[model samples]
Target: MNAPHTPASVGATQRRRWWLAGAALLALAIDVASKSAAAAWLPGRPVELLGGLHLRLTRNPGAAFSIGTDFTPVFTIVAVAVIAGIVWYARNVTHRGWAAALGLIAGGAAGNLVDRLFRAPSVGHGHVVDFLYLDWWPTFNLADSFLICGVAVAVLLSMRNVPITAAPSTEGDAVHLADITGGRDGR
Candidate 1:
């Protein structure tokens, strides 16, 4: 059996993963903090910044663009499933960049999953607090930013990686004798 690849020879193969984790953590913290601030200082009040950029307090109990707010529990379950899949994928990724992307995706999904599980009247069905507003886009949070960034990273990495087929090997080039004989030797 072939031996597993070693980290020593790779020098810094594990490097980029930390960056992904850090980005995801910072994003989640910012998301939670901003939502808290909006809840405390801007509740029910809209703040319009220059060029009509706005900040408004809101709760999203749904999927992207508020599609499933009324079914918060279902959304929460799906979020959990997504996080689980990302975590498993990240754990086994060969490329550090790909792992980072997976980690960021997992963490970001988990951050909002946390809200859906704890931030309101019911566990596993709480609303995700959203306050950042844009004139052209649906209101969203830091978790969404991380999620989108991760997706972009993953797409870029996948596009960047092209699999190369191995050349036919001397050890694998031997032909079966049965093909030459056109029948089994016993037959």
Candidate 2:
């Protein structure tokens, strides 16, 4: 029989998860720095990276590519909650990549949240800085890119179940998905 584990080991693992939190902070720093530079140096000026496909130094204050700018209050409330939840869950994430993804997303969420809190000429209402504009699409920023990519990666990772070393007490053997498979189990 496996020995009962102590709570401290679980605490250690929780602390280890902060490694990903650091990574997310780095991403957030970059996003914030870039956005600040854009707002200060190139507010209206557009830096075209590609042939009308990519741009820089544009502000977006809205959901993914300026989708919900008009509804700033609603977005801000939702964003704050999501960021809080991500930070909390990040403490228990086992997979390194998933932790990293969560960090990136948390950073992105924070980058925008900070702007909403401080960058504004008003209170609790600041526009998020965006710079990557597409002539054919809406303008965006690094934080938005990180958020979308991170969420997509997170969703994909969540679809796959990670294997656990501990087996069910009854089976006394590690379980593979095959053990659960049936004619209709493929679904």
Candidate 3:
């Protein structure tokens, strides 16, 4: 029912895992650093940027658009679950695009989870630090950006019918379009 993995395929899968880990770490680091900078620099004054964009710090205890203000702990729990699910799902992600997508989502959720766990108002009730603002949109941070971008990429990949795991090649080591698209029509 399953073909045995060659050394080269194993190596490629390992590389994909490394890419996932690297992306997660990088996203987390950037989010943490940016949040710190925003907290330090945006307390007393808000910076006005181009095209109605501004840097204004706000601590949100709820989810997007400050929804469910009374359910801070619930959000924290959900984030933890989401991160765990992503990690579990990543084990079979041999495709680099899916790996990156999952990594970004996990890292972003972890970044916000850190805030929810230790920022303020006590553990599991802490507020997330949001600094970026726009006149038409609610305030957000880098972690949210990563999450949105990751989801967008994932959606695009799905629309293109890209598989999360590499498809086995029927002819030697060469992957054919039919193998990926499941048929010659690319459907």
Candidate 4:
């Protein structure tokens, strides 16, 4: 049976939507702008600043640390799947934290995917623009930052046992939100 909506659930849904939209747009914008700036300013040679930080432009045709250098097309496909999965799962996001985390991941995926689709070489095989080298770490970009932060937030959320879906309703005769979304924890 379909359960009627309540004020609280409606508010939660609205909040989730706002959080997801805001986080995704902001992250995507920042990532794109940063990549553009890095490509333009840090092309010729590495620029050191803030003691140990270095800005170096690099084009990565692989995953993190330049792994899978021959699989740009595969990575492009994976990015699409990830973005779709996040959008599908976001309907059950009852917490702002989850929304923001998902948004960060989505934004990062899109940022990289854009490069893969339209940057150079060919469609689905373009290299990703990377910069922001620190010490001996691999050169990375804002997209990587967003992705890493999103994953860290996901781990923290899981460790806290916080429910990603709404809690059970107080009423006695209605189906629970948990039932509609998935299991009790919204996985």
| Top-lDDT candidate index | 3
What is the full ranking by lDDT, best candidate first? 3, 4, 2, 1
lDDT of 4 by residue, 95-180 (tens): 77677778998888888888899899999999999988888788788888898888877777666665666543454323343543
Question: What does candidate 2's lDDT look like per residue over 1-24, in tens digits?
Answer: 643545744544464466568867
lDDT of each: 0.66, 0.68, 0.83, 0.80
Using lDDT as the yardstick, the better of models 1 and 4 is: 4
Error of 3 at 141 (Å): 0.3
lDDT of 1 by residue, 1-187 (tens): 5235566423232343454466567766776777678889988789998786798878898875566668888888888898777655443343455555666677678778888888887899888887777899888877777788778876765564411111222334332433223353454
The clash numbers for all candidates, in the given order, read: 2, 2, 0, 0
Model 2 bad stretches (over 4 Å): 1-12, 163-187
Task: Name every residue pair that clashes in candidate 4.
Answer: none
Root-mean-square deviation of every model: 12.9, 6.7, 4.1, 6.7
lDDT of candidate 1?
Answer: 0.66
> Which 10-residue window in model 2 sums to the lowest lDDT?
162-171
TM agreement with the true structure for every prediction: 0.74, 0.75, 0.86, 0.84
- Candidate No. with top TM-score: 3
For candidate 1, the TM-score is 0.74
